[model samples]
Target: METGTLYIIGTPIGNLEDITPRAIRILNEVDVVFCEDTRVTRRLFERHGITTHLKSLNARTESLKIAEVLDLLKEGQSVAYVSDAGTPTVSDPGSQLVGSVRNEGIKIEVIPGPSALTAALSITGVPASEFLFLGFLPHKKGRQTQLKEIAQTKRTVVLYESTHRIIKLLNELEEHIGERKVCIARELTKIYEEVLCGTPLELRGILENDPQKQKGEFVVVISQ
Candidate 1:
């Protein structure tokens, strides 16, 4: 049997309109799709009228689903893997599955699309020719150490933060980074998309007084 290919497809981070035509085509053409959330992918599929079969392969079930994906590939069935949002393996699950498939000499293809990391950086105006992308920082344990390192690092640093902890993270940045220039991009590609540029303290004050700005995912870019 011919070896089936694995398509690492990137989907929209926020706005559905950000999805590329090729991504939609691959989603429609693939035999099966392994996604972080079946419900989320289903909504995307439904939006584009794609009826591809989707199975969950999030962090919780990534290990358990690897064998199933391998079995399908071995049977000459192409599979597409996608994160809940944006590109796979960008602080999302897909690395283990891709690594397992690669070891067996299976074909792997990447369908690029929207990524919050790049999206935030695009408007950051910070020289990001060489920068460190921390993705999401640790909630505890090494969190302090990581913050300390970020504070000392000279390179532009980018990280993702959740709505709930964004204010706390901003405060932490103010403590460690000490008035460093920070840019927060929230709800990228969405109708309410916003990018706030200022020192950690200034942005914290904005988010603190305005409850609405506290909502939605955040991409933080700290300049050197």
Candidate 2:
């Protein structure tokens, strides 16, 4: 029996309109959509008029729920996995599922769409052909070592930062990475979206003054 395809789909990070038509079509046709948050993904599907059944496959449940995915694929069912925002497996869930699917020799495909990493890069004006993506820096242990590494690198660096830790990250960057050309993209593609460009000290000062600007997810670019 021929195995079915497992699609790792990339959804929008903010604005729903950013999603591709191809991604929409796949989501509509897939037998099931496994995602980080059913509530979040459902809104996207609803906006696109997609009615595919959604199954929860977040970090907590992915290991236990992945069997359902593998079983469906073995039965020749097409499956799609999406995160709450952006692409799956990039600072998101689905790594384990993808690894397991590959081990089973099941067909896996990527429907590339919106990603915070690319979104920030396109507007950062840093213009680097190559850059190291750290995803999210460690919250505790090994964090300082990684910061040191970032400080020393001559290449562009990109990473995600949460709203709560945005200030902390900027301070750490100031301490370790020193002053460099930093671009902070907040709430990309949304109504409140804005990008701030400056050195770590400059950006940190700006953020500290305007408490409102510190809100929302951030994609930071530190130019070489």
Candidate 3:
């Protein structure tokens, strides 16, 4: 009997229309889906009228439930994993599960879809032929060191930030990275989606006054 495949699928970051037909098909076909938020995933499933079994597998539940997932895969049952948004294991859970499956010789496949990283870069035109993606920066400890490192890198830098700390991060960038050209994209693929281009300080000012601009997810890019 053939071992089942592990599908690391990508879902839309915000816009439901961004979901690919292939991703939809895989969701319907998989025996089970391990997702970060069952409620969020349910909306997507309902949109497409899919009823695949969903099991919560976030940071809290992953360690406890991964053994069960591995058992199912070992039983020759194909399984799918998706984060609440974007691709699994990209600043999300599933890294440990993927690593474990790989070690066990299970077949793993990636079903690509919308990513804030790629979406922001697509519009920035910031000479990112070579760049480093730091995902989300550390929240507290060692945050300054990482900011310093981002400032010094010759290549472009890309990372994600939440609404609560977007302004704070831009302020930190102004102090650490100085007048480097920056692009800040928020609410990608949504009605209110907007991208701001300027120095870190300028972007900080824009986000500070406009409470609406600071309401959604953010992707920040800094030029070399």
List per-candidate RMSD values in Å. 0.8, 1.0, 1.0
Whole-model alpha-carbon lDDT for candidate 1:
0.93
What lDDT does candidate 1 reach at residue 43?
88
lDDT of 1 by residue, 1-224 (tens): 99899999999998887888999998899999999989998989888999999888999889998999999999999999999899999999999999999999999999999999998999879888989999899999999989999999999999999999999999999999898899999999889999999999999999999999999999999999
The C-alpha local distance difference test score for the whole of candidate 3 amounts to 0.91
- Residue range with the least summed lDDT across 10 consecutive positions in model 3: 204-213
Question: What ranking of all candidate models by TM-score puts the best one first?
Answer: 1, 2, 3
Residue ranges of candidate 1 with Cα displaced over 4 Å: none
TM-score of each: 0.98, 0.97, 0.97
The local distance difference test score of each candidate is 0.93, 0.92, 0.91
lDDT of 3 by residue, 9-70 (tens): 99999988788899999999999998999999999999889899999999988888878998
> Which is the better candidate, 1 or 2, if ranked by lDDT?
1
lDDT of 2: 0.92
> Candidate 1: worst 10 consecutive residues by lDDT?
14-23
Off by over 4 Å in 3: none
lDDT (tens digit, per residue) of candidate 2 on 1-224: 88899999998898989888889999989899898988998899889899999989999998998898999999999999999999899998899999999999999999998889998999889966999999899999999999999999999999899999999999999898776889999999999999999988999899999999999999999999
Angstrom error at residue 197, model 3: 0.9
Ranking by lDDT: 1, 2, 3
